[model samples]
Target: MSEWQQRSLASLGNYENGFAFNELHWSEHGLPIIRIAQITGSQGIVDCFPGVLPESYRIDEGDLIFSWSGTLAVVRWSGGPAWLNQHLFKVVPAAGIDRSFLFHVLQASVAEMGKRTHGSTMKHIKRGELREFSVEIPGNECEQRKIAQVLDTLDTAIRETEALIDKLKAVKQGLLHNLLTRGIDPNGQLRPPQSETPQLYKESPLGWIPREWSYGSLGTWLMGKPKNGYSPQEAGEWTGVQMLGLGCLTKEGFFGAQLKLAPAGDRGLEKALLNDGDLLISRANTRDLVGVVGVYRDIGTPCTYPDLMMRLMPSEETSAEFLQLVLQSSKVRRQIQGSASGTSESMVKISSAIVTGLKVAIPKPDEQSVILCRSKALDAQLQSELQELEVLRAIKAGLMDDLLTGRVRVTPLLKSLQQTAAQTGA
Candidate 1:
């Protein structure tokens, strides 16, 4: 670590708490108001809130904003002047200290400051405590500038990579919507009418589908029944059987590598044991995240689903991959939302009765194979892009931790300090 001078946060800047504006005062024409939710670390501002205030309450550019309650983060201003909400605090750096350097110091102190929080109902970092916090400061402005430049470069890279990942995800979603809704052969050349049921191509429970495709429930093709796993009292050894929880399911699919293991006796696993090709669907969660579906493709290890999940086993006629894709479609998701039962907070619960009653159009066996192959190919391409983005993110995170903490010094950029000292004969 570099030897540095220590100073309290109050000495380097003036901390100003935000003021609350009533909902009636909010207007689109006024200055943008910054909320605690808008502070997203070094990643800069986000469009989380849309409240406005007059120029009197506006905070200038380059001011560091800290979220005092709920979610905490330190954001550096990139846009024009903006106002701060009551839940946020604006720190304006004084003449001697660099604003960007102060932002990094605040970012580095997040963990320690979080520990100082006190309250049972909601966490908070008081203004007094925040102002009293101490941080190391380099004596030379040249050194501060060099350090800030290096850290800012890494932050820029992280933001760029995140933007790229978002674009790729949007592209994948658009492709899925097109391929699933309008079949690949869109020229009307491949689709042919069936002799048995010519008018069957009309509307049904799930919108328009081909006449040859048949509708059936999930339970009709299942060999074993869907069941929930037993709840354990404590965490213990694996005993060769792993217990899958909601955390093991990612937005894309099953995350088998991060599965938590539990003893066989702990899970009370008998008929609820999971097998390869079995489908797992989240039964209860937030409205948008309730019906996530994942197919278990791993074998050689036994696993069981927790109470919040439902398992599906297809019969000889149905393809597990096809069902998995169908369940993930927006049509099924909308139906699941409609069928959900609750008072204020609704949850999608796919019971044995509901699963059996649900209908799906199944393509011919050969056609199903082709669709599965095409879907898998698309998924593989997306996975590769996601992996590359993850690596870039990790690299940026590592660089931030090192450079901002002063563990890594920029010696090459210190030449300016040497020249200044030589001229001053110090």
Candidate 2:
């Protein structure tokens, strides 16, 4: 701890707030202006400034950006050169501080600065409050660089893993589309598309499908009648019963994390109780998310679902896995969206009749099993990458705590690296 020095954020960098450009200043041409919404890198440049702006207001690649208001975040600009909008600060590292290290330091301080935020409606950290936030830094610049390098390496790995996950998702989507439309052959291979082999295809209500496939309403695949879930009032404490939130079901499948507690005195939820491998679908949601289906996996707690969702019991003839895959298909999604009813575009409801009437191209039970196995294989790869991402994130968080606070020294690690390099050179 003696090797580290305590310093305020203000002394570590130049925090320059951006210009407040109005609609009048915006143009369709010229450089894009980055706003708080673009901080996460998900949204693209919406507005632009045609005229030349001051260099201080412009951010190039690798510039540190901090959003001081509503949903505070710190990021190194990798979205190319752009103008920084107001409520965001373009941070520059002080002489002794490493730029990467400073980025990490600010990233770590977001939570503490959030605590000092003022205003009720739009919470924000004042310049004075932001300047007062303190961090511990190593006295030696080399050590700081080394620590930043280690974290940056981890960041690269995390980003790569995330990219892999995204690619897997896309691949899985394509695979599902192919498998659901063209049934697998007895030789355990995906049959070619109708365009390549029309002789093996047949025209169905849903469109061109494999000759062995038959078009039927989803109701034909169900054992028990479709049932809506029960919704209970919010309980302030644990009630021994949990209710699945609408978020529990996603296009990707069931996400068990979004469960809420059922009211303590609530009853008559027995019919709504969810069991393992139960297929659930959103009865009411946005147009895009409505009718999304997922198979529930038990969370080892007494759980019931909300009224916004419905549960389907697959009959002996249907594979719940195969049915779930079919429901997520683009054709079925479009049908669901078309049949959904609501006054607002933000929310829509689907009746059980709509669910039952939607037609699907079904293959034999054996083909369904084969298709499911392929889907599960992709799912297994995706899950592995997702788990790796979580572990990498955890490791990065631990490294930030240890390295930034001087609890873990990077000097020893650096020395070991130098020795290995020297040996390699020899």
Candidate 3:
């Protein structure tokens, strides 16, 4: 066990505000700059060549930065070396402290400060608030080092897991192209390309596809007519029933959306009750996300959708998974985009007329079942990785809350816990 000392952050180092370089200094070439946007995780950066301002404005990878206004976050800059813009505080740690440990402490502090922030229009913490914010540090630097290392290990795992998910998604994207185009032959392997089996492939309005596969509008696959859902004012009370928003549509399929509870005994309600296996598409969203399709998984509670989305109850013969995969394919997405993709601040709405008429090449009923099984396998892989990522994130949050806040001691159990954590992840 080790004793901890309390100290104000201001005593540790200078809280230098990022340089407020003029627009004239901005350039296309030279050091990319970190603005408040960059600090809040927007990748866009403004480039400023050297000599634009004094040397004190630059920040390196791993340097701790705090965005004090608008949005609050503590980030260890991992991007290329860049200039620190205004409205940000770059803490240059003083001697006798580890930067990694200080980073975790500062992150916890910013989050706590954000909760206590005061403002009507825009919440912000005065410099005095941050200056006097107290922090606890182990008297033994070695213990602080171990705790940071442990947390960093968890952070690294989280990043790697996310990276793996991204890689799997890339693979899935490629898989989708092949699965939808060539499809699984009776042998359960990807069918040969058009070049290998020209007899099996033919040219259509949508391009080359398996000869046995048929092309038709999405409307044909629906068991019942496609219809838009009802949108109404959010339920006046929290205790009312749930209504769905466009936010419910996920790339994987229907995940839950913002829970909008309707007022008790509200009108215009009965027709909109969402049923299990209902395929949903967003009629209005950002350009990139417009026409995103998903299947609704009934959450065991009655739910209804809004007018910004379309629900297509698939035909009895059609596999919901197969239809969703087709809608998500790149070619079909391009058609959806062609109909309504635009550069507008207002939401770009995809009309049911355009979406329902989307052309797709579909396999027979038996083949769709096989494709569904294969697609589910891919989804299972991605979902498994995502689940692990969620668990690692939970573990890291617990560590930061406990270890950084001094509620849980990591010193005595450090090595044993480290070994256990090592066994569990990459």
Top TM-score model: 2
Error of 3 at 49 (Å): 1.0
Ranking by TM-score: 2, 3, 1
lDDT of 3 by residue, 226-271 (tens): 6888877876667546887777886667788566886567567778
Q: Pick by lDDT: which candidate is best? A: 2
Per residue, candidate 2 scores C-alpha lDDT tens digits across 1-426 of: 887898999899998999999999998988899999899876878999888878999999999999988778999999888899999999999998999999999999987777778888888877777557888899789888999998998899999999999999999989999999887999999998899999999998988999988788999899866899998787889978899999999999999989898887666788898888889999999999999999999898999988999999888877777889999999999999999999997999999999999998889899999999999999999999999999999999998999899887888866786899899999
Residue 186 in candidate 3, Cα distance off native in Å: 2.4
TM-score of each: 0.81, 0.92, 0.89
Please report how far candidate 1 places residue 422 from its true position, in Å. 31
RMSD of 1: 6.8
How much is 149 displaced in model 2, in angstroms?
A: 1.0
Q: Write the per-residue lDDT of candidate 1 for residues 43-102, one digit (tens) a residue.
A: 444322355444435677777887778766788877677777787778877787788887
lDDT of 3: 0.81
